[model samples]
Target: MDSPSLDPAWTQRQRPPRLERRLGFADYPQVQNFLERLERLCERRQRYPDLGFGRTYVNLTIYPDQDATNVGDAEEDFARDIDGLLN
Candidate 1:
Protein backbone atom coordinates (compact mmCIF):
# COMPACT_ATOMS: atom_id res chain seq x y z
CA MET A 1 0.00 0.00 0.00
CA ASP A 2 1.01 3.61 -0.50
CA SER A 3 1.96 5.56 2.59
CA PRO A 4 -0.34 8.30 3.72
CA SER A 5 0.78 11.89 4.06
CA LEU A 6 1.61 12.78 7.63
CA ASP A 7 2.35 15.83 9.70
CA PRO A 8 5.88 17.08 9.37
CA ALA A 9 6.44 16.55 13.07
CA TRP A 10 6.04 12.81 12.51
CA THR A 11 8.86 10.83 10.94
CA GLN A 12 7.76 8.12 8.50
CA ARG A 13 9.75 4.90 8.40
CA GLN A 14 10.12 2.04 5.97
CA ARG A 15 11.07 -1.62 6.59
CA PRO A 16 8.68 -2.08 9.51
CA PRO A 17 6.60 0.84 8.19
CA ARG A 18 5.85 3.11 11.12
CA LEU A 19 5.48 6.70 12.18
CA GLU A 20 7.35 8.32 15.07
CA ARG A 21 7.42 11.59 16.95
CA ARG A 22 9.05 13.04 20.03
CA LEU A 23 7.33 15.51 22.31
CA GLY A 24 8.98 17.62 24.97
CA PHE A 25 7.68 19.31 28.06
CA ALA A 26 9.04 21.44 30.86
CA ASP A 27 8.42 19.05 33.77
CA TYR A 28 7.13 15.70 34.88
CA PRO A 29 3.67 17.07 35.59
CA GLN A 30 3.42 18.33 32.03
CA VAL A 31 4.46 14.95 30.77
CA GLN A 32 1.87 13.34 33.00
CA ASN A 33 -0.83 15.61 31.65
CA PHE A 34 0.11 14.77 28.11
CA LEU A 35 0.02 11.09 28.88
CA GLU A 36 -3.40 11.42 30.42
CA ARG A 37 -4.68 13.21 27.39
CA LEU A 38 -3.14 10.65 25.10
CA GLU A 39 -4.78 7.88 27.05
CA ARG A 40 -8.16 9.52 26.57
CA LEU A 41 -7.49 9.88 22.89
CA CYS A 42 -6.53 6.25 22.58
CA GLU A 43 -9.63 5.14 24.43
CA ARG A 44 -11.85 7.32 22.32
CA ARG A 45 -10.33 6.28 19.01
CA GLN A 46 -9.51 2.72 19.97
CA ARG A 47 -6.01 3.27 18.61
CA TYR A 48 -2.82 3.26 20.61
CA PRO A 49 0.79 3.95 19.77
CA ASP A 50 3.95 2.69 21.42
CA LEU A 51 4.98 5.23 24.02
CA GLY A 52 8.17 5.88 25.98
CA PHE A 53 8.57 8.80 28.32
CA GLY A 54 10.92 10.17 30.90
CA ARG A 55 10.81 13.26 33.10
CA THR A 56 10.23 15.61 30.20
CA TYR A 57 9.80 13.90 26.89
CA VAL A 58 7.70 11.29 25.12
CA ASN A 59 8.82 9.13 22.23
CA LEU A 60 5.81 7.87 20.31
CA THR A 61 5.85 5.23 17.59
CA ILE A 62 2.82 4.31 15.49
CA TYR A 63 2.79 1.20 13.40
CA PRO A 64 0.30 0.25 10.73
CA ASP A 65 -2.52 -1.94 11.93
CA GLN A 66 -2.53 -5.71 11.54
CA ASP A 67 -0.12 -7.09 8.94
CA ALA A 68 -0.08 -4.02 6.74
CA THR A 69 3.15 -3.30 4.89
CA ASN A 70 2.81 0.48 4.88
CA VAL A 71 1.35 3.31 6.87
CA GLY A 72 -2.21 4.05 5.75
CA ASP A 73 -5.22 6.29 6.46
CA ALA A 74 -5.88 5.18 9.98
CA GLU A 75 -2.28 5.67 11.04
CA GLU A 76 -2.14 9.06 9.42
CA ASP A 77 -5.31 10.19 11.12
CA PHE A 78 -4.09 8.90 14.45
CA ALA A 79 -0.81 10.74 14.05
CA ARG A 80 -2.68 13.94 13.28
CA ASP A 81 -4.87 13.51 16.32
CA ILE A 82 -1.84 12.98 18.51
CA ASP A 83 -0.30 16.16 17.18
CA GLY A 84 -3.51 17.99 18.02
CA LEU A 85 -2.94 17.08 21.66
CA LEU A 86 -0.03 19.49 21.67
CA ASN A 87 -2.21 22.42 20.73
Candidate 2:
Protein backbone atom coordinates (compact mmCIF):
# COMPACT_ATOMS: atom_id res chain seq x y z
CA MET A 1 0.00 0.00 0.00
CA ASP A 2 1.11 3.53 -0.58
CA SER A 3 1.52 5.99 2.21
CA PRO A 4 -1.12 8.63 2.45
CA SER A 5 -0.69 12.24 3.49
CA LEU A 6 -0.78 12.38 7.27
CA ASP A 7 -1.53 15.04 9.83
CA PRO A 8 1.50 17.23 10.65
CA ALA A 9 1.55 15.98 14.19
CA TRP A 10 2.24 12.41 13.06
CA THR A 11 5.61 11.11 11.91
CA GLN A 12 5.88 8.39 9.31
CA ARG A 13 8.38 5.65 10.08
CA GLN A 14 9.96 3.03 7.86
CA ARG A 15 10.89 -0.65 8.45
CA PRO A 16 7.33 -1.67 9.23
CA PRO A 17 5.69 1.54 8.08
CA ARG A 18 3.76 3.26 10.83
CA LEU A 19 2.68 6.64 12.10
CA GLU A 20 3.78 7.91 15.51
CA ARG A 21 2.84 10.89 17.63
CA ARG A 22 3.27 12.03 21.17
CA LEU A 23 0.56 14.05 22.87
CA GLY A 24 1.19 15.92 26.07
CA PHE A 25 -1.39 16.55 28.74
CA ALA A 26 -1.51 19.04 31.53
CA ASP A 27 -1.86 16.45 34.28
CA TYR A 28 -2.86 12.90 35.19
CA PRO A 29 -6.56 13.60 35.03
CA GLN A 30 -6.21 15.11 31.60
CA VAL A 31 -4.26 12.11 30.43
CA GLN A 32 -6.92 9.83 31.85
CA ASN A 33 -9.63 11.72 30.05
CA PHE A 34 -7.74 11.56 26.79
CA LEU A 35 -7.28 7.82 27.18
CA GLU A 36 -10.96 7.34 27.83
CA ARG A 37 -11.85 9.35 24.76
CA LEU A 38 -9.26 7.46 22.75
CA GLU A 39 -10.84 4.18 23.77
CA ARG A 40 -14.21 5.37 22.54
CA LEU A 41 -12.70 6.56 19.31
CA CYS A 42 -10.99 3.24 18.75
CA GLU A 43 -14.24 1.38 19.29
CA ARG A 44 -16.05 3.69 16.89
CA ARG A 45 -13.40 3.38 14.16
CA GLN A 46 -12.38 -0.19 14.95
CA ARG A 47 -8.76 0.96 14.69
CA TYR A 48 -6.45 0.88 17.65
CA PRO A 49 -3.00 2.39 17.86
CA ASP A 50 -0.28 1.00 20.07
CA LEU A 51 0.02 3.33 23.01
CA GLY A 52 2.50 4.27 25.69
CA PHE A 53 1.91 6.85 28.36
CA GLY A 54 3.01 8.47 31.55
CA ARG A 55 1.40 10.81 34.01
CA THR A 56 1.35 13.62 31.50
CA TYR A 57 1.95 12.29 28.00
CA VAL A 58 0.80 9.68 25.55
CA ASN A 59 2.84 8.13 22.76
CA LEU A 60 0.86 6.45 20.01
CA THR A 61 2.00 4.36 17.07
CA ILE A 62 -0.48 3.64 14.28
CA TYR A 63 0.40 0.84 11.91
CA PRO A 64 -1.13 0.05 8.56
CA ASP A 65 -4.04 -2.34 8.95
CA GLN A 66 -4.10 -4.82 6.08
CA ASP A 67 -1.07 -3.80 4.01
CA ALA A 68 1.53 -4.27 6.76
CA THR A 69 4.17 -2.35 4.78
CA ASN A 70 2.68 1.09 4.21
CA VAL A 71 0.18 3.44 5.70
CA GLY A 72 -3.10 3.75 3.82
CA ASP A 73 -6.04 6.17 3.87
CA ALA A 74 -7.70 4.48 6.82
CA GLU A 75 -4.66 4.92 9.03
CA GLU A 76 -4.20 8.50 7.96
CA ASP A 77 -7.82 9.26 8.68
CA PHE A 78 -7.63 7.56 12.03
CA ALA A 79 -4.59 9.63 12.93
CA ARG A 80 -6.39 12.76 11.89
CA ASP A 81 -9.37 11.79 14.03
CA ILE A 82 -7.08 11.28 16.99
CA ASP A 83 -5.66 14.75 16.42
CA GLY A 84 -9.18 16.05 16.48
CA LEU A 85 -9.70 14.47 19.91
CA LEU A 86 -7.18 16.89 21.36
CA ASN A 87 -8.98 19.93 20.07
Point to the candidate with the largest TM-score: 1
In model 1, the worst 10-residue window by lDDT is: 1-10
What TM-score does model 2 achieve against the real structure?
0.89
| Candidate number with greatest lDDT | 1
Error of 2 at 59 (Å): 0.2
TM-score of 1: 0.90
lDDT of 2 by residue, 25-62 (tens): 88999999999999999999888999999999999999
Alpha carbon lDDT of residue 69, candidate 1?
Answer: 88
**Cα lDDT for residue 55, candidate 2:** 99
Clashes of 1: 0
